[model samples]
Target: MNSRAIKILRELLASDQPITSDYLAHILDVTSRTVRDDIKALNHSLHMHGAKIKSTRGTGYELLINDDQNFRHYLNQSLNHVSQEQALLDSPDARIRYLVKRFLLAERYLKLDDLCDEMHISKSTIQSDLRSVKKMLEKHDIYLDKKPNYGLKAIGNEVKLRFAMSEYIFDRSETGSKTIWRDQLSTIADADKEQLDKVWSVIINQIKENHISLADIAINNLYIHIAIAYKRIKSGHQVSLINQEFDEITKQKEYRVAHHIVRAAEEIFMVKFPPEEIAYIAIHLLGTKMVSQTNMSEAELENIMEKQIQIMTTKILDALEAKMHLGIRHDKELLIGLGLHLKPAINRYKYGMNVRNPMLQDIKLNYPLAFEAGIIAGIVLEQEMDVSIDENEIGYIALHIGAAIERKKMQSSPMCCYIVCASGLGSAHLIKYKLKAVFGSRIEVMGTTEYYKLKQIPFDKTDFIVSSVPINEDLPVPVIDVNAILSDKDIAKIEAFVEEDIDHVFEYIQEDLLFLNKDLQTQDEVLAFLVDQISKTTKLPDDYLKRIYEREEIAPTAYGNLIAIPHPITAQTNDTFLTICTLKKPIDWADKRVQFVCLLNVEKDSKEDLQHMYEMLGKMVDNPSLIQQLVQCKNYRDFINTLLAQN
Candidate 1:
């Protein structure tokens, strides 16, 4: 049976109350039918072992093994015997030999009296065994230290000790009893079986392939494979065999090495690779290493990877179009991965590539596709680039562009801002209002704090600061002093401060042209579309529009003539993006009918971006003729063209 199914059964058995199939399905992230199938498989396996799994209506399956205590006792006895046999074979030295013999004979914890009586040794000799035991325990991360009242005891994480013991036992008997080891290992839950199998298979195969006829390959490979698999699994991938085919004589050796590679990849990525991919990569790497008769340097490996990535990009593009039925320009994803690979090398060079100035001739020769992909990807992902025409610019551009795309996909922001005042109440209120008015609401604000209360604040939380009062203390956040009284100049200054604080905020939005309605319609239609898009993107409820309308009734959206902005005051938005609707016919807004209406759904926390948006709006509002042209726009294309021209 598959390990996944076994895991489900184990979970079911462990639960005190009956678990529903649905609950199992959710835990396994599979359908109820799959869970049922897994249960059936578990039952079949149990039956073969002369055991039965009991199931009842409306409840889950449970193991119904008869004479549970006897079974456990038998298993323990078998383990003890194996341990004794291994101890005899491992060490024949006088000191170790005596300790091993005494340990095997002892039925319970060995007191000094019991140890002396069993071995007919002196107290000092028994004390010497204690010392040896302490030293041995250290190797297993166990401490055999004396306690206040207790004489001496082994103390450590119990699970770690158990794992250590399992490894030790497995290592001791390399070839004699495979079934005994397998039986003992079966005690591990089904969920863990796949992982165990993966580690076991890889190491065994490596040992055979490498022609390493050592008895300890199992233990050595186990340690390396487990470490690597853990890394890969954590990084979001599965572990699998690296290679399937090896000559019978060399299969085991190659498998062992393959496990080590899987572990290495896991460590590097800090994520897991799926079992199948792990297996494939392991096998390929083994074959490559064997054929080449040389280890690949990091640079050489990267070069080979670059070629593979090029192929992957082509495949992904084809898959997107053919299978997904979507037009995906994956140049950005490719460039991002490439840039990540080259990031270390780039850091070595002084004066990073200038993105704004492109050296076409140089780019065409060194990195043609990567260069183009990087520029386009950067534009799409970061919404800006500054390339200069000099010194292998294409590689650098590609790297940054790809990095930008990745950052965009991850939706990460580098800068965080905080507003500070005496009580944190008034300044926070004023700053939030002004900043939201300008930026929209995607930027992050750490939180407002009082000047005196700054000591209580977490420094890591603050990235940039806005405050009314002057403070002498140096802080990590970029401090901007502003007047308590709000004014047009104060607003302008705040806008400028935001731009300085985060250079990318406005530039990214402007470059991406996020506010542009791709297929424009009427002004109202555009507004509705914007609302719909925001709602879909943010997963806002249907009642959000109603809430906004109710809020508007109490206070009009329009601040004044030539400035009509509508928004919901509630902190319901996940992100802040503006929707500027230009009407063919003017709509009545507050005191006067306006040709254009800008809707701002500002998130409460994003002050920097909001400030940037406010600045852009302030510039657009300054032009009355431009506003008139927007109102009289005949079509969507004409409106876009006019807006672009103005910008």
Candidate 2:
């Protein structure tokens, strides 16, 4: 019924054995009923496409196509038809060539034997494939080289590689088949389709007017434009291009220059331009007929466009403000685009340029929606000016913005925490720590204030009052008073009051799992690797590692085998990083000597990571021969290779 459902179905089809409905539901993150509905929907869709998706009574759905090879061939042919219709020269051979080229691009040098092994093909077949690929490269005026001793390599222009990849991956219809868009759109309800059609119409008009070539644009942007058009229509606004009459002037040099400028604009603004606007901009800057030979230098274009766009942006903003009667709000999106355009000019006129505007700082301090947003903004700004902003600086910015937003929001319907301390700052500090730990960094703690202070201090803003100290009066807000320190009884009460809230916060902030560097030697080596990875990934204080080691002293991870697994079941770690190592010599572990050791450093709530770790460990322990191979490994890379090579 949906893209996610289709993905689940595909996964089921690819699986070796039948999958249960419950398993499908869990994997899809949907209800079992929803999964059943999805199966029915999938069956209907398959039938419409002249295929069938069969489902067993107790088992899951499977594609019932008799010939896998024929299906693949048909799919490829359909893709080729779409490509030709779109004026894209894509064929089955081209698709294979592109895949090979992409694989080659990832490596500096590749051995023919290793590649043949990787592809699971014969030497002659690989040789033929390579020859075809070499010709394709040469057609683009690129060259592939092979030395007598060395391996196959692509050399020459870097632009050629980038351009080739961009065109092949982004424009090819075969590639589009791999995406969710086709499945999702096909299954849309009739009512939704009508709504979508209206949105698409506006987008089509915009594209036509702007002369935007779909060939050059990414699918992501195309999807975004359709979404924006839908939103605009829903809001009862005319979905029209801002600059509709812009003429297309596509010279190779100018077009490339313009594309770069527009790309910079999009990055700075964090917005995708309408297809038409992108096309118009490309033509205007490049020329009418963009020849491959004609290319503008980045420096020349950046210098000129910087001054021009600044004036243009100012005028555009002024016109919008005047026409809309809504005051222009200087935000990160506006400043970034403005800064991008004016960066070169600012660099040239460093001393004389007016930098007195408070807008930049104001935007930085106020507008970002997330911690990542501030980090990205700072990175973009630093890159524009050829400067560096360290992680600490970015972190500081995020904190400032976070604190400011928290403070502003707290101004209305503020949260109150009553510190229940019998005496001293130590007890108060402990209570404060526990409260913040459970609630968050944002909870306001009114420490050891008298009952009079609770009455005098704005109680209207107080959401919850927690106190361990003696209270004479009944508080206006929910009073959570405890007799002693955070005992089991006290913790139970606190948890009961805030279980839902805590769960919601944890859902948002929880990390998935951190994979190991896939490098380590012995079980001891893996233990050491885990320690190092935990330090970097978590950014925990130095003393935290010492605490963890001290805890380990009480119970060594060696569980009576040649294998050892060391871990702490606490939320102290940010993510789970597995450090697997094979000892050159078997180490005495518990009762059994172990050649392999895996150290799992997981967050307390990370059940997924723990389960995965458990499964991997179980698999390794079940096979003694695999352990022997791992022990023979000289380095971490070799050890990982040996581990993966196992059946």
Candidate 3:
């Protein structure tokens, strides 16, 4: 099977229902016939893998698994093979990626004929590919300089070129034996690889000698910067840095390691590195890791930790408490951890260094509520210190928040679920046992009883009721319907009630709060419009717009999927409400292009478990399909219907 077949298998795995071939064709930009052929070939390969594609007459194709273990092993093998395979530049998108990589790495002009011959495409096709390549490069401040006879070359600032190369050269998602940057170096010529390895060995040795520990990705990033600096200097493109900046950078211990690393590289590669190059390497070291702070005393630690960081941490905790109402604001461990982390983080921002966060996705998925709190914390710090907090830094902050949330959970009472089963005592006991096995001590099963006895039980004693049979009675608490046999799906249904929030979402969403299909171009215009509309109904703070702008400065509320959740820095409204506005076209919201803006306002000093509502919004941020459906909504009813359907 080819890459297209792999794509077909992936799509099948992602969906639970049968997906139409036409839909797959539209996604892949191919014909329905091609999709069918690919599915056929895919089924042939899956015969031994314990999974096969089943096509319905009028519906589409679905993946039927015979053996879970076999299917998983086969899928892993296939994905690994896909990762190692050579680049397929046959399609327009693939050709554009190849063109961009080539332009980024090329030392000289690349002729149109050469590119056409390389990709086996026509001049017109190559021209179209170049346009896309230019657009992508422009994001990194790199541009294509096309000459009539000399061909096209990449022209940009040296720093921007290195940043672009770091992104394009390595496969970030590689999961094989070879390290990411080393695997990327496999594409380079043997001679260039030899030269690059010399610098890599020197950096490794010097960092080891200095007792500096760096993650694999950080090491790869630093190596790429050094490798780029080496080539540029050899080609007579020395980086220029002011004496004062160089002097200040030299004061750091990383500069000492960078100086030695460069001297060794200068002898092995026989290329002199300017002082500015050493300072550049130092910046990477400073951003990537912290020197052993364990040796410092309590007084020393306090002295080293600037007063602004303490104040910032307090502000962040206050904001988290005010908005999410997560009861982890008073966690001492969180305060110290976040405070220490921010001390170095602020330094990284000051030097304009980029740090990689490998567990960002996992943090977002597993600890979504904590991650949202981290976003709030990041905004507060950004406002206080006047620094840009990227998602990477936010991930580190989320770790502290996640830990604090865990601590808070440890302190809180377990969630109580009263069982309402129509089955006999034996069946009820079996269901109770299954629930206990799945949820452990975190969930307290408050005994099981028949539907008749359910009303006799106190409603305030339990958070929710899990039932084996449907209950027609209007209960005070939410009732979760589950199966008598207690399957995984049944357990999931019960778990949904564990973090469930009150259904105040639609209540707060009035028709007046919604602005659909508006001709808004900038973020400021959207904010002003939403704030002004809300002001007409109720009094707003005089600095409401200023507060919203401040939150944007902390980090963008645009968490991708064309959604931006902009809220005030502090709670300014007495009532909790949302003002939703959808644009006619997408506008740039920080680094993300957003069409939907959700202006959130939490009630001041209100006590409520709003985490469930935040989790629902987080799901919208993670799902593009949901965002698309919400954006298509023309009225309050349609919007509410979409939200209900998704939840």
Candidate 4:
């Protein structure tokens, strides 16, 4: 089977219901006949692996596993193989990536004609690809320096060049990833992959022996940086520090660790690192890992955190509370986490280094509210410390803020539930025990009762019903159906029920704020229209427009799938609401195109969870069908109905 078949199998595995071939074709952008053919081949392969795609007439296809163990065993090996067989230079993204690696690794200037011939593309095609390549390199302050006849060579600061190479080249070349946040690097070369693994082992041993608590990503980052340094040094290139403060870094604990690491690496690779190189590596350690012992208490860690970081963290949380009122001001975890993260972040800012966040887009898309809070935190840090914080640093801050939001959610009163099973007492009790084990104190199972006797249980006290059998009768509260013996999906459904609140999202929507399709051609025009439309009926801050623009300067609010959510850099609106504008034509955002623009305003000093509102908007971000409906809606009533239908 091809990649499309693998995609079909993946989709089937994710959904419980039978999926129509047309629906699969629509999502995969293939013909229905092609989908059928792929499904046929996919089903044939599945049968031998203890699973088969069951075709239901008039409905579509579903996956049925005959033996879970055998299927999982086969899946592990099959997916790994499929990953290795991916076409590296087939897609546009892959092509641009190939060109970048070519430029970064080139010793002499590259000839445009040679690249065109090598990639088997016309001159115009390679030139177009180079445009994107140039844009990407420009992000790291690297630009293509054109030679009269020799073609082009990438020129930038050596440190920046290494940063770009690690981010774009070595970071993604390997498929193996140990964590979900981002892929970690252990080796840069496949032929010499084993040689690099020895170095990785050596680094790990030093970290453990020193009682250092470096995250997976940090270790991986160090791996890439060290490998790049070795390569650069071997080529007679060393990072030059011009007017950088190395005296302060030398006295730091990480500097000693970096010294030990390089001393060990010298024996393994037969390469001697200069003192400046050691300082650079130490800078990385400070940025990635904060030295901590296993026996250290939270109080000890707090005491160790710099006084300046403590003040900055306090201001960050205070700003968040005053503006968004996210209800995380008192979160102790957030307090400690922010302080620890910021101390190293100060070093990164001082060094003028670009922090790479692979999860920035996902963070922006999924956690817009927290990302907004991150923007405010960055602004506060800038004001207090006089340092600029970019989107990548804001993303790391968002992770901490997002965690605080979740922790607050978990600490809230547990939702009540009554376990109802068709079988009279015994089965209900069995399910009750399971729920208790799974949820702990997060959910309070009020009581267990038969479906027929569910009325005896007080409905007023219970928030919802978790039934072993389907409940046909409508009740005052919600009903979540699960199997007598819970499966992972059943647990997920209940978790979603507890964590999400999407029903009341329209409370923030105002008919006067909704603008259907207008002739806005630019981002500025769209923002002006939304602000003007809302300002006519309501009083807004004099600098409301300025705030939104300031936020844009920090990061482009345009997330992909034809949508952009613009808001103030810091919350200043009197009430939480959304002023929306949909453009008749797409406008060019900084990085992506935008048509649907949402001006998100949060109430000042208000205590409300923006998760549900953000979740609704997040779902719409990548939904092609939903966005089309939003774009084509003609009036206020129709537009609202479309959003209502989304529920």
Candidate 1 residues 444-468, lDDT tens each? 6667777778777676765667788
State every prediction's TM-score relative to the real structure: 0.21, 0.26, 0.66, 0.71
Which scores higher on lDDT, 1 or 3? Answer: 3
Tens digits of per-residue lDDT for model 4, 1-647: 45567667776875656777765764555578989988888888889989999898877788999999998877755654543225333345557888998898776899999987777778898889899999889877899999998999999888888878877775331223342112223334321555566778878988888777777767877877887888788787788775447788888888898899888777777888888888888888878776443244567866778778878889999998877678899887788788888877888887766677778877886777788789889999888878778898899999999999888876789889999888768778888888889888878999888877877989999999999888888799999999887889998788778866454677788888888788988888888888888888878899999989998988889876568998887677778999888877777787666778888988766677676787688778745456767877998888878876766
- In terms of lDDT, model 3 sits at 0.76
Better of 1 and 4 by TM-score: 4
Clashes counted in candidate 4 amount to: 0
Best-first order by lDDT: 4, 3, 1, 2
Question: For residues 1-647, what per-residue lDDT tens digits would candidate 2 score against the true structure?
Answer: 34454455455544455555655553444577987887787666556554666777755566676666665655444433333212212133543554455543444567778766665556787777676677656644466677777786776443234333333333323224433343344232112444444444544454455454342323233433333323323333332223432332232343444455445444433446554445443432222111121133434434545554545444534432332222222333343333343333232222111111113322322332223333443444444456544332334344434443344344433256666455666777777787677667456676555444555655666566667766776667676777546777776666556432222222222232223234444444555555676565467556555554543443344432245655542335565455555544454432234555565554544434132233355545444345445655665456555655653
Across 1-647, the per-residue lDDT of candidate 3 in tens digits comes to: 55677667876876666777765664555688998888888898899899889999876788999999998878766765652223353245566777888887788999999977877778998887687789778866688998988799999877667767776655565333344346456444223666777777888888789898777778878887776676677677776667787888899898899889878877866777878888888888877765345445546667767788778878999888877888787887787777778766776777656666777755764566677788888878777877767777888899989998888767878888888888788888898888888888868888888988877877888888888899999999888888889888777667655645334556667788899989998988999999999999979889999988876765567765567888887778988888899887777776556888889888877787666567667777666566666777888889888887776
State which candidate, 3 or 4, has the greater lDDT: 4
Query: TM-score of the candidate numbered 4?
Result: 0.71
Measured on C-alpha atoms, candidate 2 has an lDDT of: 0.46
Of candidates 4 and 2, the better by lDDT:
4
Candidate closer to the true structure by lDDT (higher is better), 1 or 2: 1
Error of 1 at 68 (Å): 85
TM-score of 2: 0.26
